[model samples]
Target chain A: MSTFMQFITTGLRLGSVYALIALGYTMVYGIIKLINFAHGDFIMVGGYTLFFTIPAFMKLGLPGWAAVFIAIIVCAVVGMLVELLAYRPVRKRGNNLTSLITAIAMSFILENLAQAIPAIGPDPRVPYMLFNNDIKIGSFSISVATLITIVVSAIIMIGLYQFTQKTKIGRAMRCVSEDKQAAVLMGINVNKVIIITFAIGAGLAAVAALMYIAQYPKVTTTMGATLGIYAFVSAVLGGIGSLPGAMLGGIIIGIVQSGTSTYISSSMADTFVYLILIVVLMVKPAGILGKNIGEKV
Target chain B: MLNIKDLCVSYGAISALKGISLTVNDGELVTLIGANGAGKTTTLHTISGLLKASSGTIMLDDIDLQKTPAHKIIEYGMAQVPEGRHVFAQMTVLENLYMGAYSISDKKKIEDNIEWVFHHFPRLKERSKQLAGTLSGGEQQMLATGRAIMTNPKIVLMDEPSMGLSPLLVSEIFSIIKELQKSGITILLVEQNAKMALSIADRAYVLENGKISMSGNASELLNDERVKKAYLGA
Candidate 1:
């Protein structure tokens, strides 16, 4: 039972991170109907920001966690820049293929740019530890980092829900997603809403990156690649455009991955995760939470 | 007042509006009537800055509308009820009205505008928490119009508010439009239902093939031989 509890904790921690990253994917998809293949790189960018800033801050006798704010700002700016410089021009073309291709190209550009940078290079560096202690509870132990990951993710998720439901800008985002031209007629600046969406999505990704490296403690250019694919699958499994679906999908994928690795074999973990995705697709193609909206003529 | 002078628009090589001119004086309800593909919608879209004019000018109270972006055009106190009653399906009716008041930042004003919409559209008030998609066709039309009114615009540009409705609902919406005009809102109405549009409008313009073929007082145009033959199906 304790062993199972341990695995559950691990699953929840990993699931929290995946849920955060999936939100970035889902939101960008919701508004623009683009997959934003570059979304995963925002995590890598956040990771590197932490890698560089954490030590620098500790050297100045400040808390390493304070670096998170800087990383969030950096990721947001990078996300907005990616949207403005790359996606906006293609979006103006109003061709889905062109936008998709652009998103993939942007992903490659970010990955390669990180690889080519002299400071970053191809080396995998260990991130500074934010929380190393663990809490002991009735024959089961969970790391402080794991608890923080789940709690923080839940808090952020709830905050995001409130923002989208209660705030004016949040309503505008939904409005733009529903009918962009009608949103424009309502005096909404569509471009500004999109830019803000990218910012928020990428900012959440930064938080996910912090939680991620807290557990794995690795920073590499390609680290986000696998992580991103998993989150993308999570978003798809949950329902590509639905926020709750992304969260549920991430948790399910995380549990499956942890369970497979714990009981079956580490090597079989990914296979099982992917197999579940295939099975879910077969059964519910629109995703678990996705509505099957008929295409309007 | 809205004044559009010699506006020209094109979709690449295909000119949609070929030098059309029109005006809506303050406190006047002007209707632009035409058949399908006669550029009535095009004229409204161009005026609202949705589509750029290749040449010519659109002036709303001395502001060069040609220079304003589509999103900013509403700040000049102009709102459009697009042809399809494009309510945000996932949003509640109340939320849709809040979206209409997007540009207005004052909290009290927004509340008051919402209350005003609720007053004018009591059905919308009752379904305030309901998702817009669930509303019937006539109810959706009311929500759309109520949404535009939330902007509190000096001019409301309505495109086919009666597009798809029962005859009873058609008369109901027309009566609401009449009430809005009596309450002192300037309107530029575009419609294929020429007979209904003519009956309510103070003045009218007959658009054919992207140009204003005739312009006159509404009652006179209603009696004109050409208007009756071509539009009224006399």
Candidate 2:
């Protein structure tokens, strides 16, 4: 029972990080109808940003929480720049193929940038529990860092929900996604909305990075590599473009990974995750919450 | 309030609006009526900047709009309530209304505009929280109109607002158009139902095969033999 509890605890933590990154992929895809391959590098950038800023933040007598907030904002601003210089022109031309290739190029550029920075130590292993102390209950132990991640994630998701449901900007996003020409006629600047979308998604990925490093305590040029794959998988498992669907898919995947790893060898754990994805695809190709996208040819 | 001189718009090699020229003074509800494939919708689309004019000029209060991008056109005091009532599907009715005022800089003015929209479309108020995609056709049309009005443009452009609506809803929509005109907002109206389009219009233009075939006072055009046969089905 205690062993089972460990899996549950660990699964939730990993799942939470995957879900946050997945939100980035799903959101960009939802609005632009193209996968932002550069999104993975946004995660890597977040880790490195945190790495360099932590010392300065500590020197300034800022708390761990403040440091995380600053880091996320900085990363978000960097994300906005990427949108402006890298993605916007391609998007404006309405060329999906070019946008895809541009995103991939941006991802590699970010990863290389991180490697070029000194004292980032080439492969900066993010120290575990750098901020949070742990909480133990009955023979099972859980980190306060993980708890913080869960709480912060909940707040972010809620904020996103309200933004999309109650605001003018949110409505504009929906209209543009439905029909770009119609939205332009309504005076909704499709380009500005797309830029904001990228900023928000990248910011959330930064927050996820902080929480993620808490458990793993490792950050390298490729820190986000495996998680990116997993996050993409989680997004596909959920309905692409369906916000709630991504959340559900993440949790399901976490539980599956944990449950399988606990019972079987850890080497086979990834296989279990893949198997579940296969089952989900076989059962419902659009995913658990995906709507069927139609093309009028 | 608006003038187009020799306006020509095309898609690829095919001309959609060929040297169409017309004028709509301020405080007038002008309608363009034509059959399917006739250039009615194209003229509106070009004016609203949804489609570019290949050659010609669009001037509203002296703002040259020939080279302006689509979203910026609204900033020049024009808003389009598009065809198919393209309300934001996932958004609530209230949220859709807010989108109309998106570019407005004044917070208080935006708030007042929302209240005014709610006042004008009381049905939308009742269903304010319902997702617009779930709205009935008429309600969607109402939301579309309210959304445009939120921008508080000097002029509103509507394309086939009555399309896909039942007869009763069509009447309701026309009444709303009348109400907007009474408030002194210049309107550019396009429709397939020429009789209904001409009835409320101050001036009417007939478009055929991508050009303006005739222009006259709405009541006068309604009685013309050609207009009567093609549009009124007389």
Note the Cα lDDT for every prediction shown: 0.92, 0.83
Quote model 2's TM-score: 0.90
* lDDT of model 1, residue B70: 96
Off by over 4 Å in 2: A59-61, A112-129, A292-297, B67-69, B105-120
Share of reference contacts found in each model: 0.83, 0.69
Top candidate on TM-score is 1
Which run of 10 residues does model 1 chain B get worst, by summed lDDT? B44-53
Residue A32, candidate 2: Cα error in Å is 1.1
Worst 10 residues of 1 chain A by lDDT: A288-297
Best model per lDDT: 1
Chain B of candidate 1 achieves a TM-score of: 0.98
lDDT (Cα, tens digit) per residue for candidate 2, span B69-168: 8888888889988888777776678777767777786889988988898888988889998988788888888898998988788999899998988898
